[model samples]
Target: MARVLIAPADTRLSNLRYGKSYNVLNNMTADDVTIDALVGEEETAVEAQNVHVRELGTQNRLQYYGRSFRTAAREIRAGSVDIYHHMNLSYRWFNPVLLAGIAADTPTVLGPCQTGHAIMAEEFNNMLSQAVGYELPLPVSNAVYYPMNAVRDVTIDPVRMSLFRRTLEAADRITVVHEEAREAYARHVDESKIDVIPLGVDAELFEFTERQDTQTLVAIGRLEQRKGYDVLLDALANVVEAFPNVHLDVFGEGPEEQALREQAASLGVADNVTFHGYVDQSVVRDHLARARAFVHPSRSESFSLVRLEAMAVGCPVVVTETAGAHEMVRDGKEGFVVPTEAAEPIADALLELLSDFELTRAMGARARERVERNYDWRAIGQQYVDLYRSLL
Candidate 1:
């Protein structure tokens, strides 16, 4: 049996959408592999067995790449684990996991790392400018909107790049969620070492329920500018013109809640939109089961687990073309993929689905079937098992 150590930036398992390290640990239950977790002190709870929660002390930020690497290396050296599997190493701060693997002489698998940092930064700025009704010059805009990147370039990026190169050189295998992420990481490492492994959905939990005969559209995600809720709201405003009864239910909370509410009012769709604010997963599943369609207009996404969850629940999805998860859904089969940051195309897609119940139902069924065949956790877990065995 291969005893593997899993290390994630966070272990609380709360970030269900993007932070999938917990999901990997929970699902990889092959008889031939035993798993343990090394998590940061920030994690509130850990359900996995043999979890070692380390206090990262004061230097816990991503900019402190060396500190994080040293801390993880110390823990890895002390453990009897054979293989090291680290999630989300693209954050630049978590480059230490690669060093820890080398220090311990353990075969390492890094990533499912996904980021189009520059693209995301630009989109974020665009959304912010649209929200505030002003645009800054490109250079000034980037510096102002994405101060974190500047900070990273100054403190973390230099060290991170050097360490990342070393880590990629040493890693036995690298996994990415989609081609976009694979392309981004390929600049650093041998493309042959990379494998694309899409994230899985818990099909049983998000089991398909017969759709209710209502015009309610659902969107689930943190209320962030990148989520493009403002764009969705704009689209919904147009959608309501075609189907006046059309309603939108937004699940999740963030700093942009007030701004989104204001946007809904400005668009005159306030009455048609409901802000469900930070609902539990069970509630999210319930919404997916009953809603007419699931719409995500994210400016960028590495992988969309929520989109899969919606698909698993027999709900057709409307996603952005740039979303890495769009790769899982065939346009016009499971759902429609509209151009990013556009409301007209999004509204058009929603109107089409709402107008034809039979078409929507057929798409929903196909979406569920797709999830069963390709995105189930059990099957995804086996892929990890195979990867681990290859390294051994």
Candidate 2:
């Protein structure tokens, strides 16, 4: 039997994203594999499933005395842990776990990594403008244009040279959630070692629920500019002309809350849109099941988890083609896959769904079936177990 230590940013696995998938992996012990965890600083040890969860460092946000890090180093060096599986699901950009020196000391598996993305300079500038555009009278977007470039300047290259290089050298295997990521890592690492194993969902938890025909549409995720809620609003504004009763439910909250609300009002879709900030998973699933269609207009995404959740619930989705998860959805079969940062295509897709109940239901039924066959965590978790066995 192989021993694996799963490291995620957050120990709690209640949320719909990485949490749900890891939770399932926790209890799954197929193929003579055992699991444990090492987090940064868990204030209080919470209820962990079959795996034991351990905090690495001090409760202090800053590495206090490097106590926890040293502990992790000792643990890995001890060789009791067969595989150091780094789950870099926190945010899209970087993983501090590699820098922790854990992966370098032991055979490691890194990612469902969400890196290797290129945001258009013009679009990123526009997103920045909208985010900080609240009070600045003049357009200050150009003041620090293209954060992607800035990130590459000060962060990506340097980190890849030092920390990422160390992990790549020692990593038994690297998994990316999408083909797009494969291109990104290929620039820095051995291409043969990288594999595309996408993030998975619990189809049973998000079981298919028959939906009713309505003009209602649903969108969830942080209320950030990247989500492209503003574009969804513009689409909603266009959608209201033919169907005045057309409605949109926006879930989750972030820095762009006020900006999104203001955009909705400005677009004259305020009545058509309802901003429901920070709702629970059940609420999100309820709306996904009940609403006519789910729309995720993210400018970029490694993989849109919510879209998979929507599919698991027999809800058709309209998403941007740039999203990694869009590959899982057939353009017209599951739902529409439109161009990123565009509103007309989104509006057009929504219009088609609103006009045709049969199309929505048919797409939704296929979506549910697809998720059951492909996205179930039990099947995906085994992939990790097999990877661990190979590493040993």
* TM, every model: 0.82, 0.82
Tens-digit lDDT string for candidate 1 (1-392): 67776655452344445346656655666667776555544343444443434544432334233445555576577766678777667644345555544444778888766765434655656545654547755576677656766587678678877877787777888888878778877888899999988788878878887766779999988887778998999899898888898889999887689999998889899999999998778888888888999999988776788889899999999999764755788999999989988999999999899988998999999999999998887677668878989988
- True-structure RMSD, every candidate: 5.7, 5.3
Top candidate by TM-score: 1
- Cα error, residue 20 of model 2, in Å, equals 4.8
Candidate 2 similarity to native, TM-score: 0.82
lDDT (10s digit) by residue, model 2, range 1-392: 67777655343334344464454455355646767766654444334344666655433323422443455466677878777776663223334545655556567787667663445444455445544434332235545554546677687767656656666656668887778778877876799999877777778778898879888899988776677888888888888999999889988876688888888888887888888988778888788889999999988776777888999999989999774655689889999899988999999999999999999999999999988877777777667677777877
Give the poorly placed runs of model 2, Cα more than 4 Å off. Answer: 7-13, 16-21, 40-50, 56-69, 89-106, 116-156, 159-162
lDDT for 65 in candidate 1 is 39
Candidate 1, after superposition: displacement of residue 239 in Å? 1.4
